[model samples]
Target: MHRTAVVPCATPPRATRRLALALAPCAVTTAPRAWAARETASTMTPGTIRKQIFNDARGRATTYPPWMLGEWTCATTFVDASFPRRDVDARALARVPDTPGFRALSVARVPDVGREGTIEHRVRFVRVDGKTREDVGFNLMEIIDAYVGADAVEAVTTDGDDRTTIRLKPRASPNAERIELFTNARESGVEGDAFYVRESFRQVSLGYGTEYGNARVAPTDYEHRWTYTPLPDVPGGAVDETNVNKVHVKLVTAAYVQGQDALRLTASSNPRGAPVPKLGDAAGLAFEPVIVYTHVSLLERVGCVP
Candidate 1:
């Protein structure tokens, strides 16, 4: 689960310094009355509660307690990727042998447009070798639009070269949530060969009880699965066949103890289910086939006060 890599000799240029600073922790504030009102109303039905939670412009329902608003180490492992038509095996896709460095930085509230709210997160991903080769710039997650009680949040990532957009929405079943993320990129410096990637994920949660020493479903035991697809262009620019390359699924659980100030989170994955074939080579290296399962756990502090 752990491996080490040599640090790159050179540091990032000054122009990129702003990005490094933005990756630091940030603080956000929310309207108290709005949050309290949502919590009170959510006690009715999980379905209605979820709708209300996402509908709230102030993001009151999704806000965590103050103690839960700090930096936490995050560990992610590769799961299976599936291809729809081809005979490709999902396990054969190359794996990034080294464990990617993950840091879930600042978690806080931000100004909302109209009635919708926003939460800013400074998430940084670095290569375990201590190199800045693979890094993400300042990313923003905001509830941009809502209609008839349905809400949508756009996650924008400016990676210097291109922009990646991730759209999150509530699933048909109240217990399941879907996150659709995609981007258009060039294939081989060709203008017409635009490649698109899409991922759909679902989340579920279980709760628990205290004082009486009994176990119940907590408010945050959620399971999510994301499927990745690649679309290629054909002649005439007409719609062509869609190739599904990978499917990543995970189940996460969170619990709060009677006297503890943090919520404990644990996540697991199912990597042996299916396989995805590899596409043509890129960046010089031939894809290294791999199939992996991962488990991650963390304790996040939570409090009523900011």
Candidate 2:
């Protein structure tokens, strides 16, 4: 959970409630060390296996290098979105548009299915006890409220250590409530001077029904990888001319959904009485990527966190 290498801290970042997604660190075993192979803009594309070089965090709380800690303004652009599976059942893929992940794209103003949009938001990372971590609940509440509405978010709660739940007011009817659960996370980092992180999570949304009716349950997985290359804090050294202290970020986000058969099987079972059926076979276990969002940003230090 501790990092050995400490980069010099920049100026403090000021906090604000704006539109942005702050991809953060998670549990892992090894402290971040420098990698022989650097992550550059060209190499940080989606579907790349470069992240595999880092050690898995395996659901343990971890920290980032000193340079990455603090509040920053994240200016992101939605670059692409696609559902590229020809072999899967068409009927199953049809339901993808109704899921929360697809709905979020609309909220993010992704233009047409293949177009792009830009949004700006704030993110804060604090150093505690010589280790750094994110304010997860605060970030979720701000993001949901910004995209949906101020009244859309009901509560953001955390259990034990890693589990987090964001409860939202039902979008359709007052009789329903929507819940997003971040159950488990795997975050890994390369050793040394690199500021790269690859984090994945298993998330589920419930009661996210459409106008027809409330969706009983929708399970999804998300993989977020960020390749951050730091910039010098000298005059005209920043990616954004206004901010001398900054880091360039390449962020790729992918959403995956289980096959229809597995979803139906899981839905039909009773969690109170019987154990949910396991996805033992390849077909059942196959989680197809339905949406991918790629964006580049300059994280400028707005303020420092104590």
The candidate that achieves the highest lDDT relative to the unseen native structure = 2
How well does candidate 2 match the true structure, expressed as C-alpha RMSD?
11.9
Across 78-193, the per-residue lDDT of candidate 1 in tens digits comes to: 21111111222222221211111110100001111111121222222233233222122221231122111223332333323332333234331121122222221111111122
* Model 2 misplaced stretches (Cα beyond 4 Å): 1-58, 82-95, 98-100, 105-116, 169-176, 191-193, 208-215, 234-244, 261-285, 288-290
Candidate 1 lowest-lDDT run of ten: 102-111
Q: Model 2 scores what on Cα lDDT?
A: 0.48
Error of 1 at 80 (Å): 9.4
Question: By TM-score, how accurate is candidate 2?
Answer: 0.61
Residue 7 in model 1: lDDT: 16
Model 1 TM-score is 0.18
Q: For this target, which candidate reaches the highest TM-score against the unseen true structure?
A: 2
